[model samples]
Target: ALPDAIEEVSQADQDAFNQDGLGYLADKARTLDALPSDAWEPDLAAFDALIASLAIEGMPETGLMQGSWLWVGQRALGSDAPTPVLDPPAYEIAFGEGDVQVRADCKRADGTYAADGGMTGALSLTLNPTTMQICSEDSQADAFLTALSQVDRFAIAPGAHTMQLFLPDGSVMSFAQAE
Candidate 1:
């Protein structure tokens, strides 16, 4: 039956069917009324090799942190209060070779903040913002600056599109890659 089925299939159709097709056939063979012992033993060496070739050796080290990230929101600080984000005043952070910079646009004015540190390891960040130009209302800009100063570590999501900075005061600032 298998030989007759193979003979009926065209060469192009056979070529189009890859290992996944073989896997499907093998699975179907298991549920059939009768089949040869070798029917379900499709060679999986190619699939294993493909998987092995795509495996990453270790956690991503530096590529994800080298871009501008826009502030989405902050983690809820307490049980009663929810995290609030002021969308009009965009807050952003940019990572350079070994330095970092920050920008926040408050309704009244905008500020530029800079620091002189970067990722110390795969999951660690150390930023000591040396200069801050406080041109906006002190409350929002001051809170954002304080949070930036306290960020000692960071975590990037698997796809590297989203990130979170962990602050010493148990707050997490969430960010997404700037478009």
Candidate 2:
């Protein structure tokens, strides 16, 4: 039997992602409204309440995905923990308009992608079947290809420096923007 399609967030998972990874938010360095004179203070109590209300309403967000990325390794689907790649630079993916270029170990493949995240950031991608050409004995080409095939959705980090392709079974393949 398969596990539940929608797993409720455990307390552990919820706590892990909350208030963490606030690097960008921390750097925001913004105060709602400030008065030039030290003696003057803007009464933002009502404004604070309004801002909290709007946040509860939720805003749709989108991130740019077209670019080159070097495979960084894998992580749990919804987690930010990093797992180092054996030889990070060997694998990479370059996404263009409706198409993707993949470099898996010693093999290369061209394919297509569809991202209709609309407001939710959903994505779909497909790649040509892996080639049969022999790779180095230690190469993980086949495994990488399999992971790519299972990617159903993705998320890009705040700085657009990292991307994670999440598989249905909870394996997330991570990639970093290529220089």
Candidate 3:
């Protein structure tokens, strides 16, 4: 009994069992009082091929899990919005064994500063051990700065985390921590 429980079965054996048509084989064996003394190789090979061709699909993740921050924003600036456009918003992530520090800089192709060819105001985040602060250096860029201020603090763990930012006008940005 122990040997039967622990014994291994091979793919070939499995193929042979399936190919033999379990129901039919059982009936024939019962009627004949035993299996045919002749070879049953052809039926076994066909079953092996069928099992070999089968593929299994991957399953998606499921569980109750939460991240530090979650940012959600639109892909386009607005409907029929002109180019040299800026993204809605995006999240930034990093990892450290103890505590991690991360920074993000977001700027549009359009000029927000007086500097030539410089994108509008910069949106940056400085993440310390347990705290993350998002800020904008240029006061003239109130839209981005105000957006940064709305986010409070988040609790980060050793696993994955996310950050989300939203503007007063309802624009949003989000990022996630790496696994």
Candidate 4:
């Protein structure tokens, strides 16, 4: 005869199951089953060449940062540099149609901008004055605006997922692209 109740599970066993281990395996099997038999063997060399071209397309272009981005924080050069920390809903900057939309904590602002020379490996950014509203005492509105004002150039990392704004004094403001 079988026991009516099962034994309790341990923490390690639960961890080993992952968040949805069985579900993950099931999905993978389903995907394989959905594939046509002809696709079982692929031209790996052709796929590799196509992927290489896609990488080139991702390289920086003028105003490549045009889109919404989430601020990851700022950092200055050298040994005393402070580590970047993310505060949820920190700040978001949007660039498009020759304009920049800023969300600085509790405050909001908008302005026009020009991006030139990115093709030459040097992207020059110029921003005009923006309309600003005062924010709470604990807000970093002032600092955020100040940093934007000082940005003269910018660079986008590989995969075009991260952008770094550069100031004349060598300060860097990093941001991750928004979905």
Candidate 5:
């Protein structure tokens, strides 16, 4: 359950959102002498429908799910709270590939340039029916990549590839197939 303060604030915000009805009242008030009273109902109805459709329970939001998970000790009445243990997080992104191969490096949460999120190196994957291998680098691209061939192998479906690089630290760096 959400906190009481959060719930109250959300309710107040929703009430405010509904009360103004897409700022029609303010817009009309600005042009009070310009437009007649009959030009309001249809616009109001459209705004109401938009608000109703945006309800969380009524509709589900779709996107990549990402967040950090942490473990913290409960605060004691007479003792100082323990420091929070920050567990590493996995960020999943999907992109297109011409062949049955996709490769990406584990980046920081901001996804700027690549930093070692403790994967082997850059993550490379090839997906064919019942065969999947997550390699550190592209063997076909360079002789050096082929030399570092300590690949972690797995099985996956053939048509499209979704790669997950499981770090030694028990978190996953995954990329879902991009649409």
Candidate 6:
């Protein structure tokens, strides 16, 4: 005859059964059931390509304007009609050894600029546009392009990460390095 009460199962045996048997099976079942037949799936190839492109886009180039910069605001001399650029357009400037390039959301200006006089407080820049493309009707772009043409002096903040370009009208254009 069978015993009325069976011996108590050892704690080690119970733990092993829970981890290696039931737990393993439960995990496997969950993994298989996690995705439904109608569930949407991402295209890994495209995802990987997008990630690669973003990485490349974030990389800083080699030169003075090697890193990416964004427009913060502008301070004019007398009036502030262009009030603090609350939602400033997506504008950027990249400087190289002897070139300055600008990219606004709807426009682009690429030309040669000289910064040699910057050291002696004779800072000056000239944007002789070789190419100008207008993609959209952007007033901020217009303002920036106009300001770029008028900028004659520039100052790099003590940190060297922030920059200010002074226009002939005493207006100042501010920029900060991108993360």
Report the error of model 3 at residue 69, Å: 6.9
Per-prediction TM-score: 0.48, 0.60, 0.21, 0.56, 0.17, 0.53
lDDT of 4 by residue, 1-179 (tens): 22354456556545644654544434454576566655654554565456556645665435455567777878775324544644525688887656678877877777776665342133443545544666667776678778888786667776667887776565677788878
Q: Model 3, range 1-179, lDDT digits (tens) per residue?
A: 11264246556655655664433333444554343433354564575467557665542111112322223332222323222213222332232222222223342112111111111112333332322344356322234333444432222233334343323233334444334
Candidate 6 ranges beyond 4 A from true positions: 1-66, 79-82, 86-89, 117-120, 128-138
Ordered by lDDT, highest first, the candidates read 2, 4, 6, 1, 3, 5
Q: How high is the CA lDDT of each candidate model? A: 0.55, 0.66, 0.33, 0.63, 0.30, 0.61
Model 6 scores a TM of 0.53
Tell me the tens digit of each residue's lDDT in model 5 across 1-179: 22477556567656665665334323433464355534665565576467556657632121111221111111222233422212212222322222222121222111211222122223333332222444344222222122112223211223323334332222332233433
Poorest 10 consecutive residues by lDDT, candidate 6: 116-125
Q: Pick the candidate with the highest TM-score.
A: 2
Per residue, candidate 1 scores C-alpha lDDT tens digits across 20-117 of 45333434433552544344445345543554467466532254445788777787433233266576246777765455666665322223333222
Q: State, as a TM-score between 0 and 1, how close model 1 is to the true structure.
A: 0.48
- Clashing residue pairs in candidate 5, if any? none
lDDT of 2 by residue, 1-179 (tens): 22354366556544554644332222221221233333234435655455446542333323434468888888754457757778767888877667888888888898988874422244677898656678888887777778888786677886778887777666778888888
What candidate 3 gets wrong by more than 4 Å, as runs, is 1-102, 105-146, 152-163
Which has the better TM-score: candidate 2, or candidate 5? Answer: 2
Model 3 TM: 0.21
Q: Note the clash tally of each candidate.
A: 0, 1, 10, 0, 0, 0
Q: Is candidate 3 or candidate 4 better by TM-score?
A: 4
lDDT of 4 at 124: 42
In Å, residue 90's CA in model 2 sits off its true spot by: 1.3
C-alpha lDDT of residue 156 in model 3: 27
Candidate 6 lDDT over residue span 1-179, tens digit each: 22354356557655655655534433444565465534425554565466556545544333245465677788766544435654444788877766777776667777776663322222445666524656465347778778878876666666567777777556778877766
